[model samples]
Target: MTSQDLLLRILNKLFLGLAAAGIFFGVMGRSRAAERPNIVLILADDLGYGDVSCYGATKVQTPNIDKVAESGLRFLDAHSSSATCTPSRYALLTGEYPWRKKGTGILPGDANLIIKPGSTTLPEMLRKGGYKTGAVGKWHLGLGDGEIDWNTEIKPGPLEIGFDYSFIMPATADRVPCVFVENHRVVDLDAKDPIQVSFKEKVGSDPTGQEHPELLKMRPSHGHDMTIVNGISRIGYMSGGKSARWVDEELAQTLTKQAVGFIEKNKDGPFFLYFATHDIHVPRVPNARFAGKSGMGPRGDVILQFDWTVGEIVKTLRQLKLEDNTILIVTSDNGPVVDDGYQDQAREKLNGHRPAGPLRGGKYSAFEGGTRVPFILSWPGHVKSGVSDALICQIDFLASFAQLTGCRLNQADGPDSLNILPAFVGDSKMGRDYVVEHAFVLALRKGNQKFIEPGKGPKFSKPTATETGIDPDGLFYDLTDDIGETNNLSIQVSEKAKQYQAELEKLRKEGRSRP
Candidate 1:
C-alpha cells in the first residue's frame, strides 16, 4: 500500500484525464471547423474607382466606408471582370465572364431575364452551405423567361439564381418599369394597373422624353431619353406598376434599412447579405436631406447618401457585437463615370475631385479605371488593418467563401475563382496568375503589365463616353509605370504583350461561370 500503490493510482488518474481532454478538444475541433463566418458583400453600382474616401475621392467624403477599410484590409488593385453594369454584376455573382452568355450586355429593364434559371450562383452556393442569403437593392441580372407576362409572377430572377430573398430594381434606376421587384412579384402593383414594358416602341401615352423636354427634371446628354418617370426621362417605356415605382431619393434609406434589419434578424445564425447600392449611379437623385451636401449636384449628393448608408451598416454590426464573426467585403461593380447618361454637370462641376483616383479609363472602357475599383475587407479579430496591393477580382469570392465553409464549387461553375483565404488573412502575397479584363472584347492583366487588344474598341456607342479607350489601337501599359494608363506600351514591349495575349486566350478557352 506504500509507493507502488500510490504510483499506480497516480498513473490511472493521469490516463483518465488525458482521455477526457482528447474527447473535449475533438468535439471543439469539429465545431470550429463547422464555424462559418457571416458574409456581407456590399456592391456599389456604377461607383467610380476614386468615389470613396479610401480610394481617394477628394470631391466627397465617405467616412463610414473608409472606416471599414481602416478596420480591415484595403485592396488597392481590385478589378471588376467587366466594364459595364450588367456584365460586371453577372460575372461577380456567377464567377464567370459576361461574354460567355450571348445577348447579355447592358440589359434594358424591359428585356426578359438573361440569367438562365436553376444554375449555380454565389448566393446559391452559400445557401447550400447552411447560410441564409439575401440581396437588397439593384438586380441587373435580368428576370423571367422569354415573353414574360407582367400580370404573372416573375420567374428566374435573383431568387431563382440562388438568393433566398431579394428586393431589387429590375434593371437600372434610369430605366422604366422603375419599380421594386420583391421575390417573384413587382411590389405594390395594383391588379387594375397591369404593367407593360418595352425597349422598342411605346405601349401607351406617358409623354416621351424626346417629345416632352418641358417635363424633364434631369435631361440626358446622350441616349437616356425615352420614357418620362417622376419628371425624369428614362431609357425604356412602361405604362403601369405605378404604385410599385421607387422613389429615387429614398433608395439609399430603403436599402440601408433592409440590410440593417436582415443583419439584426440573423444575428443568431450565419447569413450572407448581398447589399447592392444604387448610389452615385445615373439619375443621381439623392434625398432632399443629403442634397447639396457634397456641393457637386446630385452625383455628389448621392455619394453622401452612400456614405451614410455604409455608416448605418457598420453601426448595426457594432451594436450586434458580431464584428469578429463577420467577414465584410466592400467593392464596386466597376469604375466611375460622371455623365453616364444624365447631364448632371459631373464633368463640368467636377472641381478637383478625382473619381478614378490614379487609374485611367472609367466605367465602359478597357483602361485601368474602367475595371479597377476600390476593394476593402473587415473582420474585427480575424483581419488586421493595413493596405494590400494584392490583385484580386470580384469573381474570386465564390472560391474564397466556398473554401471557408468546406464547400467546393464545380470547375464548370466557378472556373476563374481562386481561393485566396491566405491572402485574405494577409499572410500570402499571391492571388491569381492572370485575370481577363473585359470592356466588350477582352484584355489581359498579369502581374504589373496590362495588354489590350486592338479593334472594335469597347465603346461602340456614344453613351460610353470618350474616356472609354476608343483609340484605334491595342492598349498596353505597365501599371507600375503608368497608373493613369496615359502612355501606350504596345510598341515598346511587344514580347510582354504576346505573353499576356496567350494568357487571355487560355483563360477564355477554359471559360467562366454558367447561369
Candidate 2:
C-alpha cells in the first residue's frame, strides 16, 4: 500500500476510537447524572430541638418526623447558621454566614429581596448539576427589588435567585400581605382590588388589630397588631387583594399540596425541593382535624399539623416510587418560641412540655437551643439508619451537595460552606472542626467548647419570654459537659475563651470561613 493510504487508514482508526470513547463517556456522564438523588429539604419554622417526639417531646407526637429518623441517619449536633428565620435561610441557600451580609435580619412583609439576582445559590448550583429546583411554603427571605405591587409581577424573588418554580408566602404567617406568591405574581389576586402593603404606616382602610380589637379572632400579645386578615391580626398593614389572602387554618394543607405537586411533577429525575413550612410559627391555627388533637391548644395542635405535612410529603414520595432515590432532610430554621406575637395559648398551656428540650434559651437567643435543631437525613438504602453526632450545619448543604452532584464551585461561591458530604451521609462521625452560631450576637463552637461573644442587650426578651443569652463579658461553655449552657466557664477557662474569642473575631473579619 502507498504511504498516503497507510496514513489515511491510521487517521480513520484514531477518529473512530476517539468517537467511541466520547460516546462511552457521554453515557457514563448521563448515568452519573441519573444516579444523583432527588433532594427534599424540609425546613420547619421555629421548630425547637426538643419539639418532635424523636427529639424527646412526649407532649407532641411527631410520628412522621420520627419515621424519617427510623429510616435514616439522625444528626444530634446539627445547627442552623442563625437563630432567626430570614438569616438562617439566607445562610442555608447562599452558604455565606448571614452576619456577613447587612440587612439579613428579620424583615417586614414588604422588604426588598436580600439575596442578589446573579448570586450563586444552592438551587442555582443544583440546576447547574441538572436538577429542577422548587421552593414552597414560607419565604421570609423577602421578595421584589424594592416596593412590590401585589397585583403585578414581583421580580428578583426565588426565581431570580435559583429556584425554577416558587410558591411562597411573601413573609411569615403573622406578617401582612398574607398571600401566596407563585413564581412572581400574587396567587389568585384580583386586578380590580390592587394590594398595598406598608410597614412604616397603616395602609388602606382595613380594620387593624390596634383599631378593631373587637373584630379580631386572635389578639396580638405584643407587636403583631396591624392589618386584620381572616380575623387574625398581623404585623404591617396590607390593603385589598382579598381573593389572594391565605387562610391561617388551611396553611399547612395549602403548602403541602404545592410541595407534593412539585415532587410529583419532578418524579422522573433529580429535583431539589426547599419545602420551608410555616407551621409551628406564630398565629398557630391548625385545621379542624388537628385543632384539639394535642390537648396543648393551638401551639400543640399546630405541631401535629406540621407532622401531618411531613407525612404527606413522605407518602407522596413513596407513591411515586421515588423514596429510594430521594434524599430527605428534615430540620428547622431556628429554635422554638412560645409567644412570638399573637396571643396564642402556646405559653399559657405549656402542660409540662419543654420546647427547647435540654438546651438552654431559644429562638432569638445566643444559646444552644437557638441554633441547635433536630436534623434528620433519610435516603432509604443510601444513608445508614443510625444516630450521627456529626457537627453539621445547614450552611454546609451547598458545598456538600455540590460535591455529591459533581458540580465545581468557584472560590467565591459558597464561601462559608465546607464540603461535609462524608459526615452528611453517615460515612464519618466528625463534620466541621468548628461552626459559628449567629443570633443577636455571634458564638463560635470548636469541638465541644462554645464561646459567646460579648454584647450589650436585655438578658431576656419579654415578648417571647426567652433568655437572650447575651452578656457584656464573653461567655464560654463546654457543651459536651453542659449542653444547657447554664454554667458559664469563661472565667475558669480564660485562655481557651480568649482563643475562641480571637478566632470568632477573625472569622467575622476575614469574610469567609470555608477554609
Best by lDDT: 2
Global lDDT of model 1: 0.80
Best by TM-score: 2
- RMSD of each candidate? 5.4, 6.6
Q: Residue 126 deviation, candidate 2, in Å?
A: 0.5
In model 2, the worst 10-residue window by lDDT is 23-32
Write the residue-wise lDDT of candidate 2 on 131-196 in tens digits: 999999999888887668778788989999999999999899988889999998899988899999
- Candidate 2: where are CA atoms >4 Å away? 1-34
TM-score of each: 0.91, 0.93
Q: Rate the local accuracy (lDDT) of all candidates.
A: 0.80, 0.90
Mark the 10 consecutive residues where model 1 has the least summed lDDT. 24-33
lDDT of 1 by residue, 1-515 (tens): 89999999998787556534443223323233366889888888878778887777777889889889899999888788888888888878877777776877988786777766667778888899889998999888778878767677888788777888888888878887788888888888899988888888887888878999989988888877888888888988878878877888788898888889889888986899999998878899889999888888788888888888878888888889888888888888888887778788888777888788777778878888888888888988767899888888887877777767767677586666676665665645667666778885588887888888765644544664546665456778887877878788888987777777776766667664232
- Candidate 1: list runs displaced more than 4 Å: 1-33, 457-464, 470-472, 512-515
